[model samples]
Target: MIWTFVNNTFEPEEKATLQTGDLALQRGYAVFDYFRTVDHVPLFLEDYLDRFFHSAQTLFITIPHTRSQVRAIIAELIKKNNLPESGIRMIATGGYSPDSYTPVQGNLILQQQPLQLPDMARFERGIRIMTYAYQRDLPAVKSINYLMGIWLQKQLTEKGLDDVLYVQNDLISEFPRANIFIITNGGTLVTPAHNVLAGITRKKILEFAGALLPVETRDISVAELKNAAEVFMTSTTKRILPVTEIDGIRIGSGTAGPLTRQLQEQFIRLQESVTTAPYSRA
Candidate 1:
């Protein structure tokens, strides 16, 4: 991927650079954010960048560029690459240090990669998910450390589950890569309030369903989830997908419910409404 920075600069040697010190070998102090676009228009870019800066602040990692500068760089990167539809990932490493415990400097890397469409069959028939005992380390910040998800993927697949849902105590937290929501029997939308990443698509769905549905953001028990009329998950890449079965139990007639399908249609319309024309550098 091409690397660019402030002052309208491009780095030719960034691809070959590697960290050799303690931070590279031992410490795993890093954070990142990934967002994608469709038909050339960035999907919720402002929100993604805002979250990226917030994650940086929470992790105490200094970004290589200022927020505005980074935004400009992103726009330029998209233009230079002529990316019509792609995924953009930005990473910040704690940098090389004499000791693993402390960082000497920080390195920032941004990449724009081709977007890979997910299997549409999974959405139509819904996916099966297995529950995990562990929860995310930093629920709020999007970090590069994803060991738990990595470790559980194979086990989940082997168990005939498409994904893993993290269960802490009796509460159903979230899926490995998506935020979850359940439609209760009382028609309330229940989901984990705290200790979960606030997904961009999740936020938008809540906004669109405002006042139309009684949205309750709180801890939902696994038992409560089992009795849910409809269960769904949201993410940038996955959009809104129904969870038809969880650990062999069918969820809400074992098919995509009416509410889930309604929201999915709304989401598609919202995506199509965004401007996809190439953005000029600001």
Candidate 2:
């Protein structure tokens, strides 16, 4: 039986329900963080939890459980579900509001779903993104606000593209669900420092890739990005995915370049080393 954690209780997934008056349901108010497991071990769990709590605070929704308690709950949930390879999503929603608009103490929900990583062919051949001139509100918080991204799906499908790359004020911001990076013609690695969610996978890439190339976290203009030697995106699901085309503009011989391949190889090694033991952010 599929299980989900709803308001401190583990219930059958189908039976789990949130109050209809919850701010999350009433007005789409919530924050969430997701991470994947491999062989029953969660990857970078500490980092995910830290971001989840930060998101909750940013949304003015207080999670009832302390960090340690949340961790224990996650462990128990994982054990109950018995899904060795899956994705775990933790959500904190604005509670059932008296007026249906104001924030209140939050409700916590945890779900385990099938893991859906990028296919091997996508990694080998890379992806194509259509650029959009938009900036997300509260980009730092992993909030439950994917309206624009979801709305653009029809456009993506119509354009035969893989995803949307967001740009703001002439600078590349990020993808709808991932953090973007570029290897400059000068062989430096760079990603945006502001106006984007700071993904944990992005952090790990910066940590590991710094030894091999000069790395920077600063604004990258669209022209500079389109001319980059290699372009890629990082996230829990799409680790070090190459971006071969942006708005039909070819990036580096229209293929995944040498440096992108190197970083992908490095990330593979890191992925293999992960275990169920608690991860240290430091």
Candidate 3:
């Protein structure tokens, strides 16, 4: 059984429906955020909530529920579903609008589904990344505009690529969904400082890695990235994924590097230490 939180209560998935003329449907005008549950606990709840509110403000929309209320609702959904571990997607959309684009009343939906991640072998063998050049509009906000990613489907399949990292000018921006982190030849951890979503997973990786090595949060150029000793990507779903190749060129012997493995191990350790309290009133 699956449960969805819409309006103010939990309902069966089939019963939780949106109208055909809703802005999210009519105009694709909405903002959303996603995070996962581990051992029945919402991971990085504060950070995800912060980004959610920031995205809402970026769209000039207001969520009707308070932070505490949202937390309670999440806790209730977790308990009700009894899924233990799942992906939670929260969306605050521009509600029913007669004008079609303006925010009338923000429609909020919380959805839970089984968590999906790359297999353990992918982490060991690493994966591949291909490059494209297009920057996201309102780069700071996580909006529902994925026209480019959707448009890249043909190119991705024809090239036999796993994912695409977007670049602009000569500088690399980020992947369509994840943050890029490259290990320089001089032994520094570098990621883009601007024009990308500040992901919670990326933030936590930087914090944990800073204690052990040199970390630089700045604009990374495509030329510099090509020469890096190692490259990796981070997101709520993949956690830390090593990139062994980009644009058909090999990265770091075309295999997952030591530093990337070390950080992935450390991230798992940190996640294990996270508890179920404080983020919820339950």
Regions more than 4 Å wrong, model 1: 1-16, 22-25, 276-282
Residue pairs with colliding backbones in model 3 are none
Report the lDDT of model 3 for residue 196: 95
Q: Which residue pairs of candidate 1 clash?
A: none
Ranked by TM-score from best down, the candidates are: 3, 2, 1
Number of the top lDDT candidate: 2
Give the distance in Å from residue 264's predicted Cα in candidate 3 to where it truly belongs: 0.5
Higher-lDDT candidate of 2 and 3: 2
Q: Of the pair 2 and 3, which is ahead by TM-score? A: 3
Give the residue spans of candidate 2 off by over 4 A.
276-282
Q: Candidate 1: minimum summed lDDT over ten consecutive residues — where?
A: 4-13
C-alpha positional error of residue 261 in candidate 1 after TM-score superposition, expressed in Å: 0.6
Better lDDT candidate (1, 3): 3
lDDT of 3 by residue, 99-157 (tens): 88788888899999989777778987777778898999999999999999889978888
Q: What is the lDDT of residue 279 in candidate 1?
A: 55
What C-alpha lDDT do the candidate models reach, one value each?
Answer: 0.79, 0.89, 0.88
Candidate 3 differs from the real structure by a C-alpha RMSD in angstroms, to one decimal, of 1.5
TM for candidate 2 is: 0.96
In model 3, the runs with Cα more than 4 Å from the true position are 276-282
